[model samples]
Target: MTEVLTKRKTLLEARDLHVQFASRGRKARAVDGVNLAVGEGEIVALVGESGCGKTTLARTLLGLERPTSGQVLYGGAGLDYGSRALKAYRREVQLVLQDPTGSLNPRHTVYEAVAEGPRIHGLANEEEIVRDALSRAGLRPPERFFLRYPHELSGGQRQRVVIAGALALAPRLLVADEPVASLDASVRGEILALLLRLREELGLSALVVTHDLGLAWNIADRVAVMYLGRIVESGPVEQVLTAPRHPYTQALLSVLPESPEPVVLTGEPPDPTRVPGGCRFHPRCQVLGVGRAAEVGVDGKCKGEPLAVLPAVPEPQVACHYAAATGS
Candidate 1:
């Protein structure tokens, strides 16, 4: 297989990534032959269904789970987990998990949790480190929240504390996995705003893993749509969301709970273990038959064979074979 070279200065790059697990005496590809890149100081959102590889990909990016076969390059250099580069990479790339409550230690106070990273890395004085992290996370009057434990704070406060911990290391890239999922509806907006503010203030890049299209629409600069361990489509947010090209992508956007009731796709998503032949989504796709194919001018791409590799597109290349059909 030929490698696709990207000219953009990628802060983090995953090439032909494959993450698999042993189950029932066979390897299950949780993340299969994936390719992804995050540009310097850019926010790229990874969106997909529940069983898709979003979480697994995020974990792989952080080096928490080693891919069976692949290369993770940090700053154009390959990630060597056993070397000093790995340690430095960890400091540069931090993760903010989905469950804020579970992520923080109940025994440790907010100050302790936030200061843990700097202490481990021996990066700063404890007092200044805690204070600075709390301040950066918008947990003003840092002293007020210092002694508070996870149970002592509200949902929003707990999430803020977690964010503070991730920021303590002053990471270049932050992988936020459903950061707002556990928060109250009212607080969701506030958290999103806080993230945007931090991005501007710290000049940090982010990879937000979310299943909610609306949230991605509101926050992400570019969106990467994942399906069954592969990126089915990816492009600028407006182009992908407003006029989605991939059949699966279009079906996904149509089901979003927007006002006026978007197009409801018939049938359900394919089973993960028993993916259909050709396009994994073809079984559930509504864009079948001659007329619809001609409408998009991508009839052959979708019908011929399951695309083993992502086809090239003009803007921010999409993985889909029928990307041009969507008129994006």
Candidate 2:
């Protein structure tokens, strides 16, 4: 992982990022103190369960949501929020949302859909750019699909069009939120393959946000396990997925089809509007009051003292008292 970092340039980064919202007169910390990065032409997967703030983090990174504090950087420069600056920044950073059906306009033809970005950015050679993007997105014979509307295409084709739209802009990084969650089993692999091929052919970098660890294993160069509103564990895909140090990550992986001993977590994650003082995961953490944590005598701290935010580094990092105590 360190070698990969040294070899490639860091394209996009988040520093102590926090996104808060006013909910029922309380602050909901959707993205709390997250530090992450994606290198040039690298794929990083942000995996977590639903409502774990992965989507919010993705939005914040795309500049859709303003952070309460902290900053997002691109090419080592802080993001500018002014309308013109944001518009220019968006051209370099595009988002491929979860649902293709919703992302596309049923009234718009495939050509219009793919041409939207180039048009908005006032780029020339519209026809050529659209064709190139479509072909690159695996929709060969691009002219055949140009006149087709969203309702006229198959699920996989619609997704390809979505990818083409992002590709049309020639973005430096793609922040994909649940990129394949809406596709059928057979089609999911196709999109994943397209993303990989794009990275190889175009040197495109991606931040893939999904809950599927298997997806991460298949496509990601690195994996970040998010819980509640923070990244609890992250490292190289081979390291973190194979030997997860955080209990939350362990619990998540145990439910996969191949696990011999599954770990079942009780209760729901606490509300972000009222996060617990100690470890935010303490109430539902299986390792806190029993097993190794109790033996290591950090059980009390687990319920009363918050763990420091995990730093973004090349090596594996886990934010759990038990993990820190045992040095695993």
Candidate 3:
């Protein structure tokens, strides 16, 4: 198991951040008071199923989505997403979207695409910057691909071009939202390797959002498991993945091809807008499966605990009320 270094500076942080949207006349808190951080020279994966708000959290952390409440801090200072400041912050922290097809413009050549950020920032030596960025992104002899359009490249190549564009800006952090989810299995490793390589060579931090546990295992130093907009468990990759404390995390693992004692979740995840009282997961919780309004402890606390986001805890935070009993 790979272990993350203990002492590292935090590059970005989300302090109890919440991103809510009004959908179908009900409020949906896509990012429900998430508290997370990406340390310098470290890689963290936000792992969860679809609609768990991983992307929304990434957008908010990058200052692309305004939080309904709470704060996003860069180096411990609050972010001001005003046009000029946001633009400057953008140059320091870039984003790689999930879809290369939608992200890259068909009309733009690889050179043009890579050059756009430097041009927008009015940086000198656009040619050197574009070439170096592409080279760093593994398009060796970058000149060879300069004139090609998005359609002319393979899916992996197109994704690399997008990554190169981000690298052109010379960002310290990369918020990659499912960077390789669309590619063939063969190409996924290549892109993941590039990210780790960038971290080693350039001292870059990354917050990779994806549903693939294997991807997290492959690259991240830490893993944060999200369920219905809140992180239920977070810790070192090996600790979280190998010995998950949260019931949901256990449930997710049970279905894995190599999982030995998989815990199957009953019923679909609850609706975000209409989240249940007490524990949002109580309805589908295996701990409560014996019977609804089940009693636990002398006070029967499990029957009714207020439904609020879990507070910050020690490493490997688990939100389940019965995490201690169930995990053991």
Candidate 4:
């Protein structure tokens, strides 16, 4: 457990979570044996490429998708899937999607969009709630946006509106999926700052689902790197990002603009439906491909023995046979 998590209450947790989708005769394992947690008022980033199951894990945590096995827990209690229980759960954990333009209905005004959640939950003082949420989301003088449409706002403002909608319910956590992916670079910074500000001001906890390592470095207290339905490495942002042990994580960081030399893995990640055996990342691992595994006498294990699922803890952990054996 990181110092942050140890000091605060665990707001959400996933234990050995698995999500599978069956189509035709094959089952796609979207999330496989994952264990993760979010501390109260902490921000954790789920980092991975597309098809790596980060999004699926986020959906499962939000109660949008039921796990094939394992559990999603809130405040140490297993989630109840009953309608009333789920509805009540959602009020405390809200989702902010990638595209603000698509997230908001064109016909709905800003007030309606922000007020929608409080109204549905039958919360009193709808106007006050909406206005406060909008202001907190950085749309100063919230009344100015009440009658505006999505088309009328800048990209950043539109995203703020989407965030405001989530805020209206007084959610304790926000699961923002690629929250700044669609915005301009400058706008992206603004949105990231808004999230930090919200956390500082409201003690908000967030699970930010994104592929951008830079964004994780900017905002997350911890980061979990996922690949082919599993977390290959995870720990405090500084430890994982600065001294990454897993080859997959090293490759990701190497590609950053500040990296001296980029490490490029060959080919795309394997299909989730037919994940490679042993180390799922071995097929594209730079260390394995360069004979480091063989030099360490772990080549056979890398191809035949699967690593155990990584436990979400404070210290950095990497689930690579070569890394574990060689202490890389």
Largest lDDT belongs to which candidate? 4
C-alpha RMSD between model 2 and the true structure: 1.1
TM-score, model 4 to reference: 0.98
Where is model 4 poorest over a 10-residue stretch in terms of lDDT?
Answer: 1-10
Tens digits of per-residue lDDT for model 3 on 173-201? 99999999999999999999999999999
TM-scores, all candidates, are 0.89, 0.98, 0.93, 0.98
What are the lDDT figures for the candidates, one per model?
0.80, 0.91, 0.85, 0.93
Clashing pairs in 2: none
After best superposition, candidate 3 residue 137: deviation in angstroms?
0.6
The lDDT ranking, best first, is 4, 2, 3, 1
Query: Would you list the clashing residue pairs of candidate 1?
Result: none
Candidate 2 global CA lDDT score: 0.91
Better of 3 and 4 by lDDT: 4
Please write out the lDDT profile of model 4 over residues 1-328, one tens digit for every residue: 4665678788999999999999578999999899999999999999998989999999999999999999999999999999999999999999999999999999999999999999999999999999899999999899999999999999999999999999999999999999999999989999999999999999999999999999999999999999999999998999899899999898888889999999989866668898988999888988888898899899999999999999867678899888889787
Indicate the residue-level lDDT of 214 in model 3.
83
The residue pairs that clash in candidate 4, if any, are 1-314, 2-314
Superposition TM-score, candidate 1 onto the true structure: 0.89
State each model's C-alpha RMSD to the native: 3.9, 1.1, 2.4, 1.1
> Of models 2 and 4, which has the larger lDDT?
4
lDDT of 3: 0.85
Q: What are the per-residue Cα lDDT tens digits for candidate 1 across 1-328?
A: 0112234457888888988887677666788778888876667889998989899999999989999998888888888888676777888899998798899999998988998899888885788878988988889999999998899888988999999998889899999999999889999998899888888888788999999888899887778899888888877787778877777787678776663545555566544455556666654556654257657666556655677755322155555545555644
